[model samples]
Target: MPKIRQVEIKSCRLETYSSKICVPLPAQNLPELLSVAQKLKELTPDLIEWRADYFSASDPKEIIAALEKLRAVIGDLPLIFTYRDYAEGGFVNLNLELRAAIIESVLKTGLIDLVDLEWQTKVQVREQLLQVARENKVSVILSYHDFQQTPANESIINILKAQQEAGADLAKIAVMPQQRYDVLRFMETVLYFNTHYAEIPVVAISMSPLGMISRMAGSLFGSAITFAVYGKESAPGQIPIEKLRPLLNLMSSP
Candidate 1:
């Protein structure tokens, strides 16, 4: 299996299973976003992800303006563009095609380092997204999210395997654990995928309060990228970057 070639952004090198600490920027106002961006620059997060769905509008002009501001402040740091749809637990109201167009425009700017493409999208849409990202040299993170009950262990592992085969630089699976057993099952899949499939880096996480430990302990089992909120959390159980930074660092230590 093919793996993501080690790549460097700013000074961060993604080698093997290095942890990427991302701070989600979810401001609803553009001007307010700039202030938050400045703060994020000060923190110098490993990656900055924009929940474009949080914006008041999804127009290309608005997207361009936002990316430009991020590029200006972020310099060469990596940025991940994600406008999650309502069905997939996002606030965006546009049709899927319009969303894809917005992402295509963002890719053309050469501003973002990666784009979070949902695994649940139509096959045609996924193909087009892969093409756009490839042409722009942006990495595509094929993501799967189950806000409901956690799927069985076999199902989760198959999803990761399928995502890797789908030409993704990284694979992300987020599930909501209903109980302690659910959390253990989620981690078991992470460990199996990480050990058996050395090519793609797997991001396995559980949501809700019961799933908090997975966020802090992911690095131990082989999760490469972990999401941390900067201002407001886009998900149910996201720990703030400030708090997550220390905890994740402690966990990553040998």
Candidate 2:
């Protein structure tokens, strides 16, 4: 089969989202996962994400089944498997073995195109996970989230650089901006990195109403992708993908 062509999002890292607004189907059961994917497909989202920690069964067999069902509906559009753990603002607290098992299983099949791994996982564990993903042609988005406060611009930039050095295809950082200055700092980091680092895509977002501008301004600063909710939200400051679609489209237009 011919490789499916991706959109050319030039101003930033990539161009053109499938234009299908993605909804978060944060469900655990296979049936529930598939149901949400189908709904998002009907709604015409360009992609779908399986918040894997929400899966009803963390067992390998059941997880693979759920993923396969999701891939069926997503077709060629990108699919992201986000197994967010509690330490990083997710609900899952599975042991490293289980976490690694799930990640390896998913990537081994190449069913999902992107995997969301936390930036602070053990180095050995992360190295192994990245190896499996790279071998399987999957991209890793090393993500960091701080609900309390935003880090300094230099720290944020360092975080992105760390992820890239750790073999990530992209670097994503989200924090709570306490004031307008915090927001400005985050934007500056994004803009500077976007202009200086053309090889890697950086996603810099703030997790509050004030941070909404970061999401809206992602393309301008060279963010490869931005997270938006479909039916349910997995994080703070996530605009509905429906609303985000037009916002990004308008931003992309000269």
Question: Which structure among the candidates has the greatest TM-score?
Answer: 1
Give Cα-based local distance difference scores for all models: 0.83, 0.73
> On residues 128-151, what C-alpha lDDT tens digit does candidate 2 reach at each position?
898888898887779988999998
Q: How does each model score on TM-score?
A: 0.94, 0.88
Question: Candidate 2 overall Cα lDDT vs. reference?
Answer: 0.73
lDDT of 2 at 53: 84
Q: What CA root-mean-square deviation does each model show from the true structure?
A: 1.8, 4.8
Kindly provide the TM-score of model 2 when superposed on the true structure, using C-alpha atoms.
0.88
User: lDDT tens string, model 1, 79-150?
Assistant: 889989788888867898899899889888888888999999999998998999999999888999998989
Relative to the unseen true structure, what is the C-alpha lDDT of residue 244 in candidate 1, on a scale of 0 to 100? 90
Cα shift from native, residue 184, model 2 (Å): 1.7
